[model samples]
Target: MYMKLKCFICGYEVYGDPLTNTQCPRCRGILAVHYTNPVFKIDSRGKGVWRYSSLLPDVGERISLGEGLTPINNVGEIYVKNERFNPTGSYADRSSAIITSVLKVRNIDTFTILYEEDFTKSLTHYTHFVGLKPSISIPRIDLVDLDDILFFISRGIDIVFDNKPLNTLVIKYLNPLTVEGLKTIAFENYESRIPVERVVVPCETGLLALSILKGFKELKERNVDVDYEVVAVSIKNRGCQLLNNVREVKVVEVGDREVFEALREAYEKGFKTKPLSALSLYIAENIGKSLAVVTMGFKTVTSRESAVKKLILEILSQGKPMTAYEIWKTKPIYTLRAVYKAIKDMENKKEICFEIVSKGRRKIKVYRLC
Candidate 1:
């Protein structure tokens, strides 16, 4: 028995090797990481996340960088661990490095392929630094002629996958290290400050939040005076909304069609955004179906204008709603008249149902799904 894992939902503990086991039998929830050694310490002098190697899965010649000890800064109520400071940048590398390292030690000879561009680069950089060759399977690697990405993957890169995985195992294997790496941040936070009142994490697949939860649990076991709630912020996208809803996590759907717009903007601006979740949020909101709120009182944050724009664009792009607009007062490049004009044009084409139900002296245009 090297590592111990516990169920996130039922709190059932399993004492065994981590390489073979996957799920919790008690509640069928995914098993979370738990080291057998609670008081394990690492050489802080070492470079990279490997400094905390004692807390990770047992592996040979662990991969690393000057990864951990990320700066903890406060933003209003949020305490950000500025994961952007990681060596490969972004916190994903921390997890990828650990997963790749463990697989390498197991002699799995596994290659990693990420669906995202920046992530692929991060994976390659860290894996190579750890003496493993990784590859990238660019979804559009061929659609757009690449200068460097092409040469790298062609040269026996260890991993790359662009089209989102239909298989959950691919996601799980590729992501084991991320959960492991993210745990370190929580450790540092608990040791540095009073446990947070709440943690707001930008969740793509819920792994980050899951890891945070596991890390905090570890702290609590050690008698750390830590108290906090985990809030996994999800988009109004399809895939994520469904998963989050099913998992019973609070899902906040903001914006209209602007949901997708925010995603596109984030992608174009080189920020991380999960479109699937955003799409799910949109569909759920329109249908008036929602998941339970995890806590009695909590605040949901979203940009209404951006969400509405995303909703409108999704409708127009799908050729279902004809057109859309912003009737509410807000700041954006799109003005009130532009919204109305676009709506009128689309209504004339019968691309949408244009109805103005009167609210006192004011009239509101409502577009129905066609």
Candidate 2:
């Protein structure tokens, strides 16, 4: 029940709440959850990452969205771990699930998130599902896509631009619970019974790479022999500091052309993934018996229908009849097709009513809440 938070750099341990004290007070290093009497056992009947609960902390109720257990595809000589199949279409769902569980167990209902690239979207979805009020901090709002921006707004998630620090739970890669969840990827890979000569991963904050290494280390501690090397690919020259001096870790930088080529190749092969994932495949192309971890996929046009429908109902509830185009321009989270689909579904359920009105020489459909 009581998991010790140990600093990754200095080995300083804290016995209190891991969620509140994310960073080591002494060395300012990131803290990792250290469990006592840790044992590795795969529950044959368990689903997703929950199968490895014996190795994870028992953080009350398990919050999951069917994350993990992604298919391992053999492309030529490399094995690609397609993580884009996760519930929220990103590997971050694994981390978000564990973090949300931890927060829920601690009776924390609201949290803040520092918005990163793909991870932010996945975190937003998970947090919303778990009934957590997420206050997001970003450098610039325009940097985020219109769909994601509207989705967050529709969910009533607060967006702020100030850099002021908050005392509430802030979701970030530095959190130990996140890393603990990510370790399941390594566990799943080890369980696949495939000969792993090398593992290729895209290194953003170095959290995923470090978590995978820790997972393999846990296996090694249990007397399971692991001989594979870790290859971290990055788009920049200077990678993350977390993997700065890690042993047997090779960091490679790839150009945009290489990333685009890998993306094209992966899409052609029926894997529509993000560029970060494509970078992993690009690095794995030169390695022998490699396993590339594809992190995320492109968001489908109609993926956020429920959220868009809720927004539409809320807009109509304000006693103003609005056209579909007006709602689309206001929310902009759902594609035109998805908005129409939600409208049709709501109309059939008698939750809303629509009327055709003529303005000038054009006729448009306007909807109002019933």
Candidate 3:
């Protein structure tokens, strides 16, 4: 299984360790995975993304948590790829499974992930399942809730809060393995046999968008008549450097308010997802018939000893009253709904008390320790 890493910018190719040499030696650009004598076939008996294993790299002993095969639904004329239905409640699970499988095959039992708390969670779950140890680096502990932090800690995953790079395998989007796993999303969409005019994806780093485009490219290589525009949407002021060199990609920028509105609309349509995921829906409203990938679903932090509840308790334990919004913004890792749920649950157990506070024209409920 000879795979080549080609620089997405200069087209310089190299046959080296992808885990070690992530950037191209010539152009220092991001590398994409290319298999020699690529074969495209479907194994109907395979599960999740493995159904299209013939199209993916030959990473032995497929590792999976039943990711992919997400349902595609129509909201009016727009088609939505509900990726939140993935095993870890995120599309990243698809890549995590593939990356972990590669590590397992290479006998690399340990790896580290940089940033992207959501993606880290999926990777952590898969790595742990495959008997591999994974450490994650985040900018700050406050950026994530306590439960997730504790969960990783309990799994013996080193949680580092520094810019220093670990010597071990680092699982960033730059790693072509992750992008290779993400391409399966496009394969699944193509297999659906639906008419797709365009694909609207929320772009942060743009790897997912690029992977989708690569998947379509592979389909085209297989003599499949695939014609679809790739649209990358970013929240205002956030640029996607990954899509800069990619051609024919239409980039759109939206504000925070638009994303909030999209979240509300998506919720009204029975989809409770993150703001980034909702951005796809916002773009879909403008474009005619397009496929929008809802990346993740909003979940309530229900653990009593979870970081959100612990932070709420710590705040009220000071004997100072605070509103739900105040608690939400204080340590914003937890959603407002999750905070409110924790407050109600704490109140039920007589762990906290609340009072009504009126500020100008608005009335708000404030909470404090009992």
On TM-score, the leading prediction is: 3
Pairs clashing within candidate 3: 146-307
Candidate 3, residue 115: how far the Cα is off, in Å: 3.2
Q: Once superposed on the true structure, which residue ranges of model 3 sit more than 4 Å away at CA?
A: 145-147, 298-370
TM-score of 3: 0.77
Error of 3 at 210 (Å): 0.3
lDDT by residue (tens digit), candidate 1, 1-370: 2467766667688875454455667655666666665554656675576766666666665777666676654322334455656765556666767766675676554454544534555666665665666444556655433534654655556334456553322324323355687777666666566434555555555656677667777677766667766556554463232134234344444554666664553333223434533333233333331221111011122354345445454555544322144332323445554455445555677755666677689876667544
Among the numbered candidates, top lDDT falls to: 3
Q: TM-scores of all models? A: 0.56, 0.75, 0.77
Per lDDT, what order, best first?
3, 2, 1
- In angstroms, how far off is 220's CA in candidate 3? 0.6
Ranking by TM-score: 3, 2, 1
